[model samples]
Target: MMPLRTIANRVECEIEIKKSRFVGVVDRAATEADARAVIAAARMSDPAAGHHCSAFIVDSSAGDPLADPKQQRIERSHDDGEPSGTAGMPMLEVLRGHHTTNVVAVVSRYFGGTKLGTGGLARAYGSAVSEALVHARFLTRQRREIMTLELDHAEVGRVESELRRHAVLVLGTSYAARAVLTVSAVDADSTAALVASLTAGRVTPVRSGHMYAEIPD
Candidate 1:
C-alpha cells in the first residue's frame, strides 16, 4: 500500500487588515474525506462568516491491486461567496509558491463593516494564505521501507549498532530463541544494504514497502 502524504504538523493563526478578517488554518490530513471534514467543521464554526473558502491536495494509492498510477499532484479550491477567482485562485498561488503538496489550506473570512472590492479581496485572501504557510509545520517526505532481520543473541548488539549507524529506524524487536528486529528505512536500497551488512551474508531480512510520515509535532 502506498503511504499517504500530508503536512507533518498543524498550524492556526489569524490576520486582519482594513476591517477584513482572514482566519487561516493549516491542517494535516491523510485522506480527502478528512480534508472535507475539516472544511465542514470550519464552516459550522463560523456560520455567519462572509465566506468560507478552502483548498487541498491529496494522494491515495494504498494497496492498489491493479497497480493504478499514483497521483503526484491534486489541487482544489472553493470560492464560497466571493466572486469567482478572487478568493480561490490567490490561495492556490500561495500553495504553488511554497511547492507544497498533499496539504490543505482553508481561509475563513468574517466580513467587516466595509466591502473589499475584487482586487482588495484577492490581496486579502492571498496574504492570509501566505501567513498560514509561514506559520505551518513541515515534515520531510521519506520513503519508508520495513524489513525483518535475523541474528543470534550474540550478534544482536552489534547488528543493532550498525543499523543505528545508518539512521535505520527500529520499529520492534522479537525474541523466540533467536532475536529478530523489525526496521524501517527510507528506501529499498537502504533496507537491502542494512540487511546485508548486519547479516554478514548468513542472515537476511524480508522486504517491506514504503512508509509515510505521521503528523508532526
Candidate 2:
C-alpha cells in the first residue's frame, strides 16, 4: 500500500538570515480552501510583513507522488511578489522533498536594511520552512471506509472486542434499544468478511463514507 503521511499539528518558528526576519508556519490542510485559509491567517497576523509566500500539497494514497507529483497532488506555490522564483518555489520544493501530504507552509519575510539577491532570497525562504519543520510532528494515515454494525446488548461486548483484536478501528459506539458501533475497515469486501466471521452471518454492516485515520508509527 502507498503510505500517506500528514502533520500531527501546526508549527511556527522564526529565523533570521542576513538580518532579514523570516517567520514560518506549517499546518495540516487537506484542501485548497483550507490551505488558503492558513495563508490568509498568516497574512492577517503579520499585515506589515514584506512578503507572505506559501506552498501546499494535497494527495491521496491512490496516486504515487514520486511518479508524478504535479499530476498526483494538488500542488501550488506563490512568491507573493518577492521575485519570479525566489520565495514560493523554494518553499514548495522543501515540502515535496519531505514527502508529506495534505499540508501547507507559509513564510512571512520582513526585509532587513540590506538587499539579498535572488539566490539568497530563495535560500532564506527555504531555510525558514526547513527550520520550522524541525519542530513538526508527523503521523501516518490511510484511507478507510466507515461502517455501522448494530448488535443487541448481549453481543456488543464480545463483537467489539473481536473487532479491535482484528485491527478494526471503532470510531464511535452508541447504545439504546441496541448497540451501534461505527467502525472503519479498508474496504467493504474485507469489512463484510470480517463481520460475517465475527457474527456468524447474523449481522450486516451499513457502509457510510471514507476518511483518513492514523496508523502505528
Candidate 3:
C-alpha cells in the first residue's frame, strides 16, 4: 500500500483579506465520517460565521477494507453558500498541491461588510488553508503488518530486547498461557525469518492483521 501524508495535529489560522476574516482549520480525518465530524465541529464552534467552506481528501483504503478498489481516495469540497467555485475547490487544490490525504480543511468566513468578488474569494480561501497547513505538523501513514510473537514468559523479555535492537517496533506484550508480543512489523516474511532465527525454530510469529501506522514525514 502507498504511504500517505496527513496532518499530525489540528491547526487553525486566521487571515483577513479586504476586511473579510477567514479562519481555517486543518486536521487529520482517517475516514469520511471523521472528515464530516470535523466540519460539523467547526460550524458548531463558530455558529455565527457566514460560511463554513470545507475540503477533504481521505484515502479510503486506510480504514475500510471493503472500499471500492477503483476508488482508492474519497475527495469532497463544499462551497457552503459562497459563489460556486470560490471557496471549496480552491481549498481542495491547495491540499492536493501539498500532497495531503486523510485530512480535512474548513475555512469559516466572517463577513466584514466587503465583497471580495469570486476571484478574490478563491484566493483568500486557498491562501487561508495554505497558511494553516504551513504551520501544521505532518506525518506519513504507511501500511504495516502487525504480528504476534507467542513465546514462553521467560524467553519473551530477552527476545523482545533482541528484536528491538534490530529496529523492530514492539507495540506491547500481553500475558496469557504464553506471552504474546504484539509488534508493528515491516513485513511477514522478514518477521518470520527474524523469529525463526531468534528462537531456533522454537517459535513462529502469527500474522494479526495490517494497519496504517504513522511515521515521520
lDDT of each: 0.73, 0.84, 0.87
In model 3, which residue pairs have backbone atoms overlapping below 3 Å?
none
Clash count for each candidate, listed in order shown:
3, 0, 0
lDDT of 2 by residue, 90-123 (tens): 9999987877788899999998888899999999
Task: Encode model 1's per-residue lDDT on 86-141: one tens digit a residue.
Answer: 98888878766765656777899988788878999899888887887776666545
- Please list the residue runs of candidate 3 whose C-alpha ends up more than 4 Å from where it truly belongs after superposition: 59-72, 171-178, 201-208
> What lDDT does candidate 2 reach at residue 189?
84
Assess candidate 3 and give its TM-score to the true structure: 0.79
Top candidate when judged by TM-score against the true structure? 3
lDDT of 3 by residue, 1-217 (tens): 4446777899999999878899999998878999999999999999999999999999777666334322588899999999999999999999888777889999999999989999999999999999999898887766677888889999998899988887678989999899999887767788789889989999988887866666777
Error of 3 at 54 (Å): 0.8
| Model 1 error, position 156 (Å) | 2.6
The TM-score, computed over Cα atoms with residue i paired to residue i, of candidate 1 is 0.78
Query: Residue 141 CA error for candidate 1 (Å)?
Result: 1.8
TM-score of each: 0.78, 0.74, 0.79
Question: lDDT at 52 for candidate 3?
Answer: 100
Candidate 2 vs candidate 3: the lDDT winner is: 3
Which parts of model 2 have CA positions greater than 4 angstroms off?
A: 59-72, 145-153, 172-182, 186-210
Ranking by TM-score: 3, 1, 2
